[model samples]
Target: MIQDNIDTTTRQPIYPLLAAFAASCLLGTLATDIVYWWTADIIWADFSDWLVSAGVIVGWVTVIVALIEIFALRSARFRQRSRAYASAMVLALIVIALILATIDMLVHTRDAWTSVVPWGVILSAAVAALVLVTAYLSRITDAPAAIEVTG
Candidate 1:
């Protein structure tokens, strides 16, 4: 049974915002890769380089923030087994995405056309999928607010 007047306290998580930004920048590289492939444009490759670089940097920052959140709020956030499992899954996905992003960044360092055609695009797509999954999992895992009851 749920109470209509259930009292709860909410604290916003900062890592989700950072994750979204990193995901967007990383995912955007896929688009640029496609455009570069289609138009054979050097500019699009350049865009992919910058976007992937930024995405990788922010991805690392996101990892740091998540670690801080886990340690700082361990008692509040991971009390439930399922919540702990979900958080771990999210962290794993982020790490995987970071790895792909790093490889993609390296790929982007090559010549403009070769950099983005096959390998870069492939890595970008992989990272994009992981980021999407991470975002979705994080959303479902979010507790939103903690309920408190008083006698």
Candidate 2:
């Protein structure tokens, strides 16, 4: 049964969001490959570059979401959009990329723990945790205020 609540009216759909992310990542990979192919003349030469491509996917999503909020939030069905959710997702992708970059950096050297990108991973983890907390808090705040209808 559908709860005919205003909050429900504006709630984000999970499956569609996941699909958007997947589609966007695929597009990002294709785009990165095409660009690299044109300039570097190498096809699928840099597989790890897909990590950065994932970041680009999330980045494009953030931009599109922001523009929607700026121009159409009032009119949109999902007016109560998860702004923090979007931001946190992008940050999470960056953190993943940072982690991968750290691993990549370690691959080129003998020492693993003594690299610089690991420090970046640590910092990115901290930031990602913070963003996740913020997203949680924002979701809480976006909830409609309770009212007491005392008779």
Q: Could you say which candidate leads in TM-score?
A: 1
Per-residue lDDT for 34 in model 1? 93
Residue 134 in candidate 2, Cα distance off native in Å? 2.8
Q: For residues 25-94, write the lDDT of model 2, one tens digit per residue.
A: 4334434344444455343324324533454345455545544543444323224366444544544554
Superposition error at 31 for model 2 (Å): 26
Candidate 2, overall lDDT?
A: 0.39
TM-score (C-alpha, index-matched) for candidate 1: 0.84
Where is model 1 more than 4 Å wrong at Cα? 1-11, 143-151
For lDDT, the strongest prediction is 1
- What's the TM-score of every candidate structure? 0.84, 0.34
lDDT value for model 1? 0.79
Q: List the residue pairs that clash in candidate 2.
A: none
What TM-score quantifies how close candidate 2 is to the native fold? Answer: 0.34
Worst 10 residues of 2 by lDDT: 142-151
